[model samples]
Target: MTTASSVSRGRSGWGSTAVAVLLVAVMLFPVYWMLNVSLQPGGGGAVASPWLPLHPDVSGYAKALRDQGPHLLTSLVVSLGSVVVSLVLATPAAYALAQFRLRFTDAFLLGILVSQMVPGIVVANALYGVYSDLGLLNSLPGLVLADSSTGIPFAVLVLRAFMATVPGEVVEAARVDGAGELRTFWSVVVPMSRNALVTAGLFTFLFTWSDFLFALTLTTTDDVRPVTLGLYQYIGSYVQDWSAVMATAVLASLPAVVLLLVAQKYVAAGATAGALK
Candidate 1:
């Protein structure tokens, strides 16, 4: 009976592992197909499609890099700027909301949640008029500020949730040692919540990186075009360059993929930090 039970448990573990692999493959198939399509030779009319690129071509990547490199740099700058602004603004707000029992705290949290429901186009349209009046419609600073709106509220919510889990005793001990609120926050809370901060900052980076709506709506000229807008040019009214489009998409997706791989450790640590405490 013992031998039979051991065999059954081993089979169950193998079955679970197989299902996990199948799920991962299903989720990754589109990425695989995009890469495959990007390597196909560019020609007129509908080119033949295949599961794999038997004869891979680099011309699409060459064209993509040549045309979209500036736009990709613009995206990187805007994304990094937005991360700085979001974390600086959201961290203090989150700490206050999580620690202080203010009367309007719930209302503020509600407003943040409701802001997510508002259409991006509506916000863009509103900002367009404001930006036009302020002479910021076709500028890098404008785009960074606009993209930051996407990260700020979400960062506030995420950081607030994590801050709520911090032990009050830890904060009080910092105060007892003669540290003021700001000092305590900077010295104590911030270090304790490093994993959570990293996780929030990682997501803020990605949110601003992948933003297309503000990039499309806020900027009227090519001076501040993001890679997403650059990708749109490959699909014109009459001609569609599928290989170049796929190539641009593959390049645009790299930051998100890289950020996820790098920051996933911090995210796991943050999630488990609460349980450990």
Candidate 2:
């Protein structure tokens, strides 16, 4: 016993879903092409590739792993490092912002917002001189610090948003139970804000793992290059092997893809955690 308007709404909903699927396919075409090319035999992908890899090959992946393995490891280390540093700094800051009233708090937040508006390249160029003076230029630590500049502010906002909703009574109860600020933060607030922490950390990892500009600007040597830099190594003045290059991209994408899949629920919960509450 559906009305005409309800049937029209159902048709519109199907139309919207179809359009969304088309948009997703359009956006993911490049990724699909990359995988298709990577599976072609004998580096036949240098010129052109078929839509489907009727004849699959693992040589490109083998070559990519052989050549880019170290860089992949480097990216993993830098990404993990950035996450640790960002969360360490951001967690306390977010807690203070959400739980305490400090002077110039609004102004300080405005500053962070403004800093985000500033271009990354400008920040990179500025850090170059400081890094050179401190011997941080071309080092893993430097990359971690530079990448954390992006992560910290973002992590603070996300964590603060979620932490702001923690019931004051719950926090007070923890305090009345003889828990100190540090203990309460660690045992009570942190466990409550788990989803936001995961969300922030996942984004930080993704950012540092995929960072190219910072890798290109802060590092000049192969000693501590990330996979982003190593992937760029395949392309030069002469483009000889496209399959290996595409293969490296596919391999590099795997970690982030797997991480997103694993953390998808936490990310969703974090985003909508306090909305209804």
Candidate 3:
């Protein structure tokens, strides 16, 4: 009945909401600024862009599409290829690590964890010599393989966590029906773990899509450039078209943003399902 303590709690709750909103606004400000700049006429000509795009323009986007279209396609191919490779390799590995009592399983998992701690530059340098020897430099296949290095490990961990929670009795029941391990996995486990697969696949796509390091390291030609590395066109001693740069960035960000928004439910389900494991 409007007690003093209830009133105080209500005010505190609103205070927390206000603070959260403020924090979100602060973090999202740069994204808003990027959008504003992308819409401005010629990026407002070296002056700070105004808070809003009172006069929106599309020329920058047109130019960006003209110049970066191939790069965007290349990135799409590489990111999709990396997702396929990562899932194909990681799913079995994760299943084995999750279910099998193999020797060195824990040690192998530890090794994978340690691999994540290694610096990307070190891995890139190591791959550089190998790729040069193998004549893989500037090749799309080389970039796909290189980007999958990051995707595989992460996919394995996520998939393993979810697979670990899969009921052993379900697998056993499949075996009782004369289903081979591979068949059982495909027929039973895969369908049940769709959320985890989506989660892993989307993340792999994001990783490979944004992978500037591998693209820069493995590619030396314009023929196979991904959009992340192609962003270099906007930067140089002679560059002055900030609008083009911002437009390119905005375009580059679209796929990941769209994927996250679309698959957010699957991602959340996969994450919470894996928590106990």
**Which candidate tops lDDT?**
2
Indicate the residue-level lDDT of 40 in model 1: 85
lDDT of 1 by residue, 1-277 (tens): 9999999999999999999999999999889988888898865222455787999987878888888889999999999999999999999999999888999999999999999999999999999999999999878899889988988998888788888898999999989999999998899888878888887788888888888889888887888898887777656621456777778889999999988898889988875665554
Candidate 2 per-residue C-alpha lDDT over 155-237 given as tens digits, one digit per residue, 9 for 90 to 100: 99899889989999999999999999999999999999999999999999998998999999999988999999888876661
Which consecutive 10 residues in model 2 have the weakest lDDT in total?
Answer: 233-242
Worst 10 residues of 3 by lDDT: 233-242
User: Each model's TM-score?
Assistant: 0.89, 0.94, 0.96
Candidate 1 achieves a global lDDT of 0.86
lDDT of 3 by residue, 191-272 (tens): 9999999999999999999898888888888899999888875555115777777888899999999999999999999978
Return the candidate ranking by lDDT, descending. Answer: 2, 3, 1
Q: Which should have the higher lDDT, number 2 or number 3?
A: 2
For model 2, the stretches where C-alpha displacement exceeds 4 angstroms are: 1-10, 274-277
lDDT at 207, model 1: 83
Model 2 residue 263 CA deviation (Å) reads 0.4
Could you tell me which residue pairs clash in candidate 3?
A: none
Question: What TM-score, to 2 decimals, does candidate 2 have?
Answer: 0.94
